[model samples]
Target: MVDSIIPKPKRVDGQITGLAGELFVAAELLKRGIQTSITFGNAKAIDLLAYNPDTGRSFTVQVKAIRKKNVFPIAHNKINRAHTYVFVVLNKPGEAVQYFIVPGTTLEEDPDRFTHWFTDPKFPGFNWRVLQDLGHEDAWHVFSEQA
Candidate 1:
């Protein structure tokens, strides 16, 4: 039997998908011995705040999640330079979720990194594969370095 290149995405609400991504990130951080907290709709740009208790450092994170291996929609103007960006691919059932941890400065310094669609000019986004190719998958060390 052959496997599909892109598995069918799980049918889930957008809000739920976003929340799942945030929770998953928080869990991963905690597992790595970092303290994490979810802002839960209070913060406009930040979704998670993580702290390295050992280092006494904290940093903000913004999560963008998609149900499948697709583009993670982002508004160019809303990219916060001080916050880290975690792009998540929530694959089908029984499949492991994938994360691409990228620093916001990367996107801020490079305009070509964003794929701006002519059809939806206002909703420019980053392709999941592109992030993977850039070697950002599971880049958990970013938090350690920042926090």
Candidate 2:
């Protein structure tokens, strides 16, 4: 007999990918002296709740994994109420993955949306042109400090 079965995306693939990404982001936050907590699901409005008790402030972070440059948006509506939103772009050029952080708010306000570069009836598209013009490189930084 010949094997005639095709493989599909396993449920565990998504869970593993999500957890791994969260771990990467959380580890980075820890290195930066930010207190971080992981909320599994069904929370008030955030996924990862990170805080700096010394500063008495907290930020809600939503993580998205991308195999390509334009697979996902920088932010979603869930992060609208967050003190800060981070886009952890994972670029896997080869065996290694590189990360670039973009501010969700900036993407939302990008004027390029008027040009129809990114279009979604339910959610607005980010302005890639504006993001490029601002000289925002790919890395982790405070959302408050940007163009």
Candidate 3:
């Protein structure tokens, strides 16, 4: 009989997949004409910083990518300081993905807690409406307008 539950990928593979996915998403954002950069290390919770010359508004995008769509990503801090929180959902083989943009205020009102696997609570349980499915063309249009 086949095993119903699937096994997780090795740690190294997981990291590599995550890195590749993030880069792909970043490129997609840039192609859409949003000035963007990916920051490293843990000093700041935000991952990608995007700016719009037209609106002159800076948006902080925190990227959380999950392998499966049914499973969502979560953040403990609730992005009180960022203008926006972006959850990038990815599928295995690292091709298909979606973006969820949640306003900072929404996260600000939520509670935060610590966990064993991850540090914070309320991070992995994101809502659905916030999600926006994106491809090359759609991503470009939305980000360009947003910027």
Instruction: Pick the lDDT winner.
Output: 1
Higher-scoring candidate on TM-score, 1 or 3: 1
The C-alpha lDDT values of all candidates are 0.83, 0.55, 0.56
Which pairs clash (backbone N, Cα, C closer than 3 Å) in model 3?
74-123, 74-124, 75-123
Lowest lDDT block of 10, candidate 2: 74-83
lDDT of 2: 0.55
Write one digit per residue (lDDT tens) for candidate 1, span 40-137.
Answer: 87436689998898778888989999989988887666677888899899899799999999888877777575544412466677688888887889
Best-fitting candidate, scored by TM-score: 1
C-alpha positional error of residue 81 in candidate 2 after TM-score superposition, expressed in Å: 5.4
Off by over 4 Å in 3: 1-18, 75-77, 109-124, 127-147
TM-score of 3: 0.61
lDDT of 3 by residue, 11-98 (tens): 6465555565567667876776678888766456667788767667677776656666654445544445455655565666646666
Minimum summed lDDT over a 10-residue window in model 3 is located at 110-119
Clashes of each: 0, 0, 3
What are the TM-scores, per candidate, against the unseen true structure? 0.83, 0.62, 0.61
Write the number of the candidate with greater lDDT, choosing between 1 and 3: 1
Better of 1 and 2 by lDDT: 1
